[model samples]
Target: MTLGFTALVTAIVGEVAGTMSLRKATTGSKAWFVAVAGSYVFAFSMLSVSLAQGLPLGLAYGIWAAAGVALTAILSKVLFEEPLTPVMGAGIALIVGGVLLIQVGSAY
Candidate 1:
């Protein structure tokens, strides 16, 4: 279970990194294109490993996607000076709450 959780976390990180790289690549950075591709590969690999280690698909994917969105939004605000409005903040909170609910529901 610990290993599975760790893999899930890695998957989330990879996804966030991939998205960030995508932004940079879109701005004409060739190196970021490579990073975007590699990060996605790493993300999916970790996600698959986590599933194989016994994490439920619904639970794992929900957490992975939500964390990715939230982290990406926050990091983009920090790194790229992207605007994070109050509504967006509220949406992120809701996403986090939804993931928690899914996790608790899964335990049963």
Candidate 2:
């Protein structure tokens, strides 16, 4: 994959990790707060590099938001026992579809 894509994926992972840490810190323990700060730093750094790599704003943002939303939804369901109704699933699908369309459109 492209470097931009790689960076975006890294940012997504970092953001998710940071969010998980925040949740843990809130409902589990105090030590996890450190993770929240560190992970967010990592997340923002990755996103900055991705933009510096000349990735189009639309492509970078679309992919980032889509992946973040999808992964967060899954994580919430798994970690917090949150609901994942069919409607939610469809919304996720739509996000993915919109991201794909943006990718295709921007390629041309």
Candidate lDDT scores, in order, read 0.94, 0.90
lDDT (10s digit) by residue, model 2, range 24-101: 899988999999999999998999889999888788888888888888889999989989899999999999999999
Compare the candidates by TM-score and give the number of the best one.
1
What TM-score, to 2 decimals, does candidate 2 have? 0.89
- Candidate 1 on 1-108: residue-level lDDT in tens? 499999999999999999999999998768899999999999999999999999999999999989998999999999999999999999999998998999899878
Best lDDT goes to which candidate?
A: 1
Q: Which ten residues in a row have the lowest lDDT in candidate 1?
A: 25-34
What would the TM-scores of all predictions be?
0.94, 0.89
Q: How far is 44's C-alpha from truth in model 2 (Å)?
A: 0.9
Clashes of 1: 0
> What ranges in model 2 sit over 4 Å off?
none
| Model 2 backbone overlap count | 0
Q: Candidate 2, 5: how far from true, in Å?
A: 1.6
